[model samples]
Target: VCVFAVKVGFQGKEFAESFEVGLALAVGMTPQLLPAITSVVLAAGAKVMSRHQVIVKQLLAIENLGSMTVLCSDKTGTLTEGIIQLHDTLGIEGSPSERVQELAFYNAFFQTGFANPIDRAIRDSREFPTSDIEKLDEIPYDFIRKRLSVRIRRNGDSLLITKGALAHVLECCSTVETADGSLADLGPYREAIDSRFIELSNAGLRVLGLAIRNVDTPHLHKEDETGMTLVGFLVFADPPKADARETIEQLRDLGVGLKVITGDNRAVAESISKRVGIMSPVIVTGTDLRQLSDEALFQRAREADIFAEVEPNQKEQIILALKKGGQIVGYLGDGINDASALHAADVGISVSSAVDVAREAAQVVLLKQDLGILVQGVREGRKTLANTLKYVFFAIAANFGYMFSLAVASVFMPFEPLLAHQILLVNLLADFPAMSLATDSVDPEQIHRPRRWDVGYVVRFMMSFGFASSIFDFMTFGAIYYIFGGDKPELFQTGWFVESTLAGLMILMVIRTQRPFLLSKPGALFLFAVLSITLITIWIPYSPFSEKLGFVTPPPMLMVIALGVTFLYGVGMEIVKALFYRYLAHR
Candidate 1:
């Protein structure tokens, strides 16, 4: 609009001035470096994240990481040590039993189902003598049943061993074995089993019930799991990492809420959450979630921080619910049960050692399952996004002012505001500093909270700063005609060229940060790039080669006035920026 209006509005009056004003507006209004700058910043951030032991499968997800408002993390590998150890193997009487350990080993080592940390831990413990044992049939572990059944032939006798969550395993057992190798009906021992579970769980130990039965059939099925004798319990422990609490606190300070979604029972999840500094987090179980309507769960998902005993599919449900409630969610997981959740989250994060399904579904894969590394990734992501926004603010504000100034000057002045080549040179030179913006250091305040694209804020920024810049341009216009003698078109063009380039460069520095420009300095590379570009811009019009570009020597007063205007504009922008931020806050 600026170019077409200026061209048509002036062409009827003066052809030369119309051509100059139209071409200048066209060059000043277009932001040629924006797309290249955005790509460079995102690529640089991805490289930095890789240095912190993360692989970014999707480049654009880096920005999503910075924008993430909620992170749904699984308890086992992310917040905890990711190492499961067999704490104890106890008989039905809650006493350590070698027989129970032997049977547990058979089930753990011979199962055909997918292995997990618990299964690996059991196998890593004492090796049981099993030369006489022959593998037969197996019913693999499933989320619904929460158990694994393995039928084996030992000394020509077909026996089945089952192990899983206490409640589910207990349902399959008809009797309990006493410490004396005798069987008793399960009814009398129910209270004792409950007491033992409470005792172990209070200490934050995960308990799995073990049961056995003699089977006549060669094929094992879920139906054959009934009428078994409860043998013992397998206790496992995975403590929180040493830095887990600090990492959690750091995430909180960065304005990222943490939610733990695990298939573990509520007691264990609550225990780990408290240990990691999540005090009094609202807890929700799979059963509780199932009872709530989708709308109700969406509302509750915002308040609840710990989701326990959730099935594999329920993990995806929780993530979707959180997103539906208006959160940009990031999910971290490392197991088959986590694949769906990872796929459904806004940013899926998994470890390199995660199951193939989970890693494939994730956007980010860490070399180690540690929250510390993930926190570092979040910082890098924020820094990248901040630099990208800096260019946006600089280009929009400057171009807006540039085009408006050209339009206003074309109408009121007798000559063009700036020649076409002059406008392109100034625009390109002033924006060269922003090419190094990816290397600039970010203000701590800038990355303290998640950032998103706010079109309203961008528009307000452009209007406010652009209006101020145009005011400064008019000041230069007055000085050009009144002081430099605008009767000579060459003198008028040269003065405005120096003032526009120098002032544009100074404002670029100001808009890079919300903090007062002096307090938050840019990187060394950025400073050098700006200094080099500023020197080149000033030398262009005064050099012997200036004749070709329609430049003439300006009086020394013109350089002084340009510097004076640039300094005054910088000061005014600082005040304007501070007030702008304050207004935004109050609004």
Candidate 2:
């Protein structure tokens, strides 16, 4: 046996060389030591075996993941990748393409780092001004100013390029040109520009305004570049994920609500939401959220699907509010900013390539950073949980039938219904095969539209079936005992005959109803064979051991009575189950 096992171990060397070595060590050990060595080696191998352990761990993780009804994410890395790019530019008013490009170029060159997505986008554009320009001074980007400015000499004329937030740039501009080449007052044009900015932003585009002014040809300084002509606006943002639209639709089918929580402007977030099919009438901003109390925030969070300019702290607050309302929240993130909410979520999922801190906090890490895996993971989780529950249900019901029959026989008869070993054998034969096979059975419909298992449903079904089976088991044993006793009731002993017969009947009942009649083809031939074997075992008295176990050779009249009892018990159970199902349907 050891030599054969060692050969098989060599074939499995790719899986784990250590396992092969351990198996070989066991084969060479002393007889007593061999068993211990084999047991330890097998135990160690079980840990590394992918088949059952992977399924078990994945199922547990997925169950927790699917329970999440709310999700919180950081705006920068989570949504926009903290990178911005230009999509399309609409020159409202009479601003020329040349003017817009020149203003964008100044903003792009003046910004220091390529880290800011907007700056990189502007620098990448092909039409920006390059020739006949000499830089004089610059005012770097600032959080407070929310803008960048630079001074340059072009054709001996001092040009000031000031680019900043749309509202701030509009405020500094005294006048602007319309697209039709007419001069327009900044007041009315400001509203139109703001509206256009919103329109673009909601489509998932980031918008920045650019303005320039002609200053006196003095040695230009960074401070002198403010209060300039509104040159034009620049738009930049990361393109949406290729399958983001489809992924969002899939989530909707699974009854998961999708929301965009971003630090970008509200318009950009709204635009992305519309493109991705997350339509919600209400759009909320971080500034707006700050004004509301916690109670109001919670209510609004449920009602709103688009949030913009949202800070990291606000993400955590939103998750807490959703959870407080009895919703399970799952957070997906890959950034430090998302840490707080991720930690608080029921299940935190991070991509494998995510930051160490984020991965450490998450319960599940996707091998591939794809949203489709979430759907598949949830289905597998549901299947494993259902299979485990099915095993538990049958085990409990079978034990109840066995114990009920034994109790009745002990009270009314001279012999014990079944010995401990016989009872153990019946359970081993019936339960091991049936329950193990059930775990592998597939319900295709369940995979498509899986739902979270309700504990209440399992309890209700088990109790209904278990109670019916127990009653039937008791009646079958009682009828057999009474009938075989004949007119000389004290002389006749048939406890073993009734007990073994009841055990065979239980095996039949369990197998027949394993799958719903509507769902599975009835295996009547197999059931008949089981019943025939049971009959022969009790009546054929060829073996002395059978007689010792209290088997009785019953006459034809007693056989007829046993058959009738089985039929009546089965009919009664079907009627009860049908009525219970009807009540449940109505409720």
Candidate 3:
């Protein structure tokens, strides 16, 4: 109407004609309801997720969970129980020994830093010496060195006892404890220690290398960290949760792959990954990562499932690398060191027991530290995406088809096809039925794979479905003009309003589910709302309120024609829906 009126105005008509036409034309379509519907749907999904212990801090991040293709998770607290146990203690040469536990217990027990699970385990170990130990000084754990050193007075001398990653502590030692009860040059024992480290790691035990240096001076500088004697290893075993393997398989089925990024030994990380079904053949360490350029590391990151010996900063880099490889990544962590990687991920996920910095950096938080709950969250996220797309795709296509038919009819008809108020009444009534879409049921197959929006798919869906609706709109026009004698203005408006509103409401049941409407049941509230609104929409033209709204009671014959056209239009919509989904599957 606006385009026609503008053309007429250019040919010396009054400006008022163009302005009025533009207003009527604008009121005829209600596409602006799309944003309102989207917000409600996302908010509803967030509410559902919260009941299952998944809290969505940001409304927008809820949908990103469905789109996540890669989840980079820390081994502890995510894949396994975060509780560490002192399972075994091995000497540097071969057999079980007490000196390694003696040194490790003193280093862990005398620490002034916060108590972690590993430290608690060591201090509580049965091998802890009964004798007293006093700490004179301490060097706390740092991400760069990945170890901690404590200076304690032992036998009238200060010994700097260090405990950390096996390779790191080995680098600080110049001698290794031999089976013969003597110190040997560490160079000859390097391969044996490394082999033993891998053996322990493969058994799914976290190994902390122990070393000590005798210092005559009470105070030590950074230079005094080296020239130590490697004592042995403290092996800790934090068992995997019972449901972790099942959760991993569920995420795998959903196409959300899991990767383990941990500061533990490569052997331990790989062992845990294998037990949880996230292991890949190649195990990449922080030292190995340093050898690769950024571009090479990105490629390696895509295939490697276990990233071991990763420092705090390196964990963030691995997340960034996966994202650079065109994967939407989610980071699950609960430690201060995990804060950087969590913040850098597409969806940062943390547990309820996470440190303040980690929880604050994360967008999604799990009240239960279980990956099984994450699978449920992912399903809900996909449901939100699938239902939101239903509103956008269905409403725009159906509304555009109805409006386009009105525009084409205006060129030849002598009277306005639909008055301003009549157009709004149809839009308002149709919106009532659409409100139920948020709680509507989604098909099980629809959520089997990760879902994200595709503009090309939207365009194809709208064009195909919109054209089908237009064909039926023309059928309604033919019936109104030829059979019903809708030459009268009020009669024509009444006929189209009934047909258009019924078509819009009926299409909801068909388009909302991928399967046939009868096969899947909608929520009770939704079913009740759509049925009530649909019945009320049909009764409006015949009720006394019709007079106030500029509607006329159509003849019984015309009502029959409207219902028939709607039935046929619904059938056509179902066919188009099937074809569209088939195309989507193939595409």
| Residue-level lDDT tens digits of model 3 in 1-587 | 65566436544444564355446656655577778878888899999999999999987787789788898888897788878899988898768888787888888888888658888898888655536666788888888887899899867777899998887888899998876669989999899888887888889988888998888775767668899999888889998988888888999899999888888877788788788766465779988898989999999999898888887888889999999988889999988898889889989999898889989999999998888889999999988888788888767687878777876675456666676677777778878667768877788888998777778877787788888888999988888988756568888888888888888877777778778777878877678877787788779888989978777988998899999988888888988888888875447
Candidate 3 clashes between residue pairs 3 or more apart in a chain or in different chains = none
TM-score of each: 0.96, 0.61, 0.93
Quote the lDDT for 4 in model 2.
28
Q: What's the C-alpha lDDT at position 53 in model 2?
A: 25
Best by TM-score: 1
lDDT of each: 0.87, 0.57, 0.82
lDDT of 2 by residue, 1-587 (tens): 33224434533323243334333333212122223332332332223222322221232455554454555544444433445566555476523466576667765775553245566666776555567777777677654456777777778877778777776566667777566656666777777787778777766667777777777755655556555666577777676656666876776665566566676677777666666566664788878989999899889988888777776778788778778877767777765566777778777767666677777777766654556565555445444434444344444444444455444443444443444344444444443333333234335443443345566755665567656766776666566556554343322334344443445454345433433434543334434544555655454433556556444455566655656655565566556557656664223
The TM-score ranking, best first, is 1, 3, 2
> Which candidate comes out best when scored by lDDT?
1
Off by over 4 Å in 1: 13-24
Runs in model 3 lying further than 4 Å from the true structure: 4-21, 27-30, 126-133, 178-182, 217-219, 278-280, 584-586
Worst 10 residues of 1 by lDDT: 2-11
Q: Superpose all Cα atoms of candidate 2 onto the true structure and report the RMSD in Å to 1 decimal.
A: 12.9
RMSD of 1: 1.9
Worst 10 residues of 3 by lDDT: 6-15
> Which is superior by lDDT, 1 or 3?
1
